[model samples]
Target: MGASSSIPTDPNQRVQVIAAGYGRTGTVSTALALERLLKGPVLHGGSQLLVRDDKYCKLWLDAYKAKDAGDKKKTLKLVKEATAGFVATADVPPVDFIPELMELYPEAKVVLVRRDPEKWWKSVVALTSKATPWWLDVAMAPIPGWRYIPAFMRRFSKSFLGLAGVSDDKASPAELIERGGPFLLVAHNRRVRSVVPKRQLLEMELREGWKPLCQFLGVRVPKDPFPRANDAKAVDEHAARIFTRVLQVWVGIFSTTAVVVYTGWWLWRNKQQSLIRAWKSLKTMDVRKAFGNVWKSIRLIDLRKSFGRVWNFFKPANIKKSLGAVPKAVWPESKKPVVEHSTGYSSIWLE
Candidate 1:
């Protein structure tokens, strides 16, 4: 079944369904079913971030970080930010935050999609084996415009592998899943059961078909068969589509930025060359002569000022001395005279 046209655009709109199911547990099918039943968008894995207008990959990454930090409030906020405008969320990253999401949207019905544990693990191994390799993801990371590919891989590893306690140590998917798969399945199911009330939760397997799901959601089952998604070929095709879309977006942005930067630099260089040419032309025209004339005018003005000062000093009342002679007004007057002799020398004193 196709998604409904009635999906609301409001990011803050209350969510109607929360698929608190691990990946490989018929999540894609459940998401499709929920979208058809709810008549709104159902987010599933990276597909929503890739296909939809909402770019919640970064927000999901942030939510993972918040989860690691054990900050429930921060995790809730980030989950809400990522899942906003969507009526339902199914699959890995969303499933990892089920507890916080349950608390945040208490009114939302929880669908715990289930499958035989061994079969689920087998599916997980198969899918992860086909995933982009760790080395390839790392190698492509430093390349400009390809960083998103590695980023998506890392987010997947953290949300899926890390949560399952599978080491991202370059091990084969079979080995990693063998080590972590059983425990992850048991612990995850146990946690979900412990948290969600029986009335609010519907445990389902895709093989059980649409009736159980439709009844749980109080909606009519579609005439179409239940969605059986994430087959190997379908998974590969979806991955290709996501990669193509992401690559196109990054390439377009990179091309646009390059054009803008080159245009700006070309315009600036042309303006700079024009200024240099204008300066060289002024040099050829002997603009220094004009500067020299101005300097001469300034010096003449300074010399005129010096002459005026000299004339002022020489005016009658302003003159204080003539040659080396002292002025009589400045000399001391004698009231008595005395003579002294010392070492056959005589001196006269006036007081």
Candidate 2:
């Protein structure tokens, strides 16, 4: 079994919901729903979505230029309180907040929303992470070659989820689903059941079709299906279209720049050797593994290879290594080498 619940058991206090499921599992939508359903203040992810709103963008931009290095905390607090109009969204680096947030919001509803893992992965790569936010876009612009892609992915994926209007992006609880239909939802429900008595913990859709949800909360159901939350796929398609346009232009420019850079470097070396060797280290197992990944991306698969992932309160270090992501155990305090561009290149370019 997973270690003890990190959530408080209070049935009456402010519910703490983590919405820990992967992105695009409908976290923003749930935040929107909570803002209305909770009928009170909500403080959601702040630093992460500065680009999503003019107020936040301006605040951070000013802070970045300000001489007062200590103004960040005050500014963050102001930003949090400023958005008190609706369900507040405040997503930030997950690991950084886990310890303090859990302590700050005791009795908070810990809603770990989940969805089909494959869908989650694909949605991340396709729809959400494409923003190439200032964090990733500006920062990664200088990185060279293969070393750049990983940081580029994380900064975009974890940073501001670039979207137009804020709806589900503001307040919907985590979504739970299985490939078969609500698998993660069922599993999450089961996990919660293992700890809290079923009565206190309700598992109803945050929509009108689900009668019990409002009943459980002592609110009357609306005449409509919980306001037809507009988290529809069309929103994704629209934003994706804009991103696709910018991408084409940027890709062309970058490709040209790269060709020029490598060609000149090759001539300067006076030898025909490559800087990095060929990509021949690819393993047969990796090729075989990619077939499943391809199938999963197309929604053609729903099989589970293991349940061992559930046994730890925290996902184990060994599993992370197996997954090939930068493991949390060693992720922080690591730095990539910086390449110093020579003055010769500038002089050559000017000439």
Candidate 3:
């Protein structure tokens, strides 16, 4: 027999029900039913790791490692921490830790939800038909919680399959579901029966519904019909919503990134071409001559100032008056008109 439960019998145990069944066996519907009957929250599959606090992932991961290491005390402690607040549990990672949970909460009742093995396998295949696309991985890689999905899957799978001593190092949880055959169902049910005491255990199918469940838990049959949550159609719809959301986010991100990168590249290329053209034009010029021209332009400012003063003093009219006053012998030359150029310079021509 597995080590006996060490927990002191608590009249007010936090967890009242534990569903130690593989998923796709009406686990979702069972969870919903239990919530209504027990009047408390049930930790179902997706919420176990997907939606709840990210810290739960670490807690569960630690517990898994502890369990693998054969540290029962530590494993029990971490499992309790991981599953603290919920009144009942169902499906996947939570169901995977049945032995630990039974030990920790001896008062909690175990309900094994079963389906025909062939039908269960078919349901699993339909649910996990689409493997995560490569682009989806690339897109979700930057998301902190999402990036750890693969690692989490591997670890969780190893621990879960370990329960049956079923060695599967090659296949993923999805692949395992597809190829695992009927033996998986058989082995899991056998193990649960072997471990849990008959008095504390209740095995029920989806078809059996409220009658057995209510009688086992000593709760009144709810006026409402037993929940039929997460059927194949509902699973497909949920998958569609997730796919659409992921596709939309990645599309927007990829489109914006492509536009920004192209714009930056275009600007850089044009600027580079301009610089290259400038450099080539400079290479064709005489450096000394270019420097001399620039220097001359600087010197021209001072020369223009001096010339302005001289021009004001020696106006054309003043020059003509001075020439008339001078004798013909002194003037002895042909005179030409003063030409003013557009560049603010005046030329006096004499022949």
Model 3, 149-206: lDDT tens digits are 5556566556546655776654466656544665677778888898899999999887
The better-scoring model by lDDT among 2 and 3 is: 3
lDDT at residue 291 of model 3 (Cα atoms): 96
- How well does candidate 3 score on lDDT at residue 155? 64
Worst 10 residues of 2 by lDDT: 171-180
Q: Which sequence of candidate numbers ranks them by TM-score, best first?
A: 3, 1, 2
Q: Output the lDDT of residue 196, model 2.
A: 45
Please estimate how well model 3 matches the true structure, expressed as its whole-model Cα lDDT: 0.70
- Give, for candidate 3, the lowest lDDT window spanning 10 residues: 1-10
lDDT of 2 at 241: 47
Q: Indicate which candidate wins on lDDT.
A: 3
When 1 and 3 are scored with lDDT, the better candidate is 3
Winner on TM-score between 1 and 2 is 1
- Residue-by-residue lDDT tens digits, candidate 1, 197-268: 899999877789999988998888899888777555567776675467556766877899999999999999
User: Which segments of model 3 are wrong by more than 4 Å?
Assistant: 1-13, 131-136, 155-164, 173-179, 292-351
Residue-level error in angstroms, candidate 1, position 233: 2.6
TM-score of each: 0.61, 0.36, 0.72
Candidate 2: which stretches are off by over 4 Å? 1-20, 41-99, 133-136, 139-212, 215-218, 227-351
Model 3 TM-score, 2 decimals: 0.72
* Per-candidate local distance difference test: 0.69, 0.40, 0.70
